[model samples]
Target: MIRRSILFCLMIVFAVSLCACHKENPDPSGQNPDSSPTPTTPDTVTIAPVISGGGINLVAKLIYTVDASTAKVVRSTVMVRDDTDITPALVIDCIVESLKDESLNLSFDGIEYSDGVCVVDFDDSIFTIAGKSADLEDAILDCIAQSVLDNVDGCMKIIYRIHNEAYSTVNRHFAYDFVYMDD
Candidate 1:
């Protein structure tokens, strides 16, 4: 008798669940109210990235190194959005893309961020920017350093490396090893 009572209760619960599963939608349109798709908008200034990781897709003020002959400042503020994960390396890549007529052709091999300091390892391609005047190289580095510092939160310093090895100078001009956000 107890077994029959348990089986009967189980049968009732099964029927209730089946009924719940087939219930009609309250909306006359037959669409689930919560299943509407959210709209997405692209970043305001869509510049094609030379080295694409993906888009940051947010409008932001970025510092770009420009030809000093044409610009009032060597490094000027510009509004732009480009592809990347907002990491130090990607932000530097975006800065490279923004450079006027100077093709540095550099990329980061690895990047590590911790406690507001970002250590960036680069391939030997970093030397490609050499032979440019020391001041121009400094401007380029400043552009990269300042852009990452302004965009990525909590990143207060950037240390340079060649294939994970420490470097004291880059492009034979600017002092490397570290760039302070405060500077």
Candidate 2:
């Protein structure tokens, strides 16, 4: 009788232990037994402007993206002029025409204004083709510089690059720097 009583106590203990374990580990399917949802922390987010602004009048801070295959202006910023007299659209059109006239063999992709710099990218062909004459090369660079200078207010200098690589300021055919100013 004593042995049977001891066995009965052991069975009760085992059953109780199993019940506790089951409660502790209710579901492996990722559901909580308490039915309360876990709290989530809010995430911090950062925002950037679609179009950047604030610079000399006429010179809109711009980033230009040039088409790689067609060598055309894919996009540009609205012209920021020194004088509010000129509209941004007209200035952009003039710049585009000037670029096309120069025959740089590339097109504008787009322009983004950020900080104080105007980053302009052109097609790879701008650097690929060799000019036959020094005048032609200089004219191309001059055209580029003038186009930006005429429409943009604060751009005294242009940092030109093709496919993100800096091309020589030298006229390859003439073996001399392309002079923008007489002095």
Best by TM-score: 1
Instruction: Give candidate 1's total backbone clashes.
Output: 2
- Quote each prediction's TM-score: 0.52, 0.36
Per-residue accuracy of model 2 over 1-183 as CA lDDT, tens digit each: 999999999999999999888645457887777787776532322234356764343344343433323444344444434445442334444555544544444454443333433445455444433344455444454545555555555544454555554544335422122223221
Residue 127 of model 2, lDDT score: 49
**Worst 10-residue lDDT window, candidate 1:** 68-77
Count of clashing residue pairs in every prediction: 2, 25
The window of 10 residues in a row where model 2 has the poorest summed lDDT is: 174-183
- Model 1 segments more than 4 A misplaced: 1-58, 66-85, 168-183
Q: What would the per-residue lDDT of candidate 1 be over residues 123-160, giving only the tens digit for each residue?
A: 76556554445566556556666777877877888776
Assess candidate 2 and give its TM-score to the true structure: 0.36
Candidate 1 TM-score versus the reference = 0.52
Q: Candidate 2: misplaced stretches above 4 Å? A: 1-93, 98-105, 108-113, 128-130, 168-183
Question: How much lDDT does each candidate structure score?
Answer: 0.62, 0.47
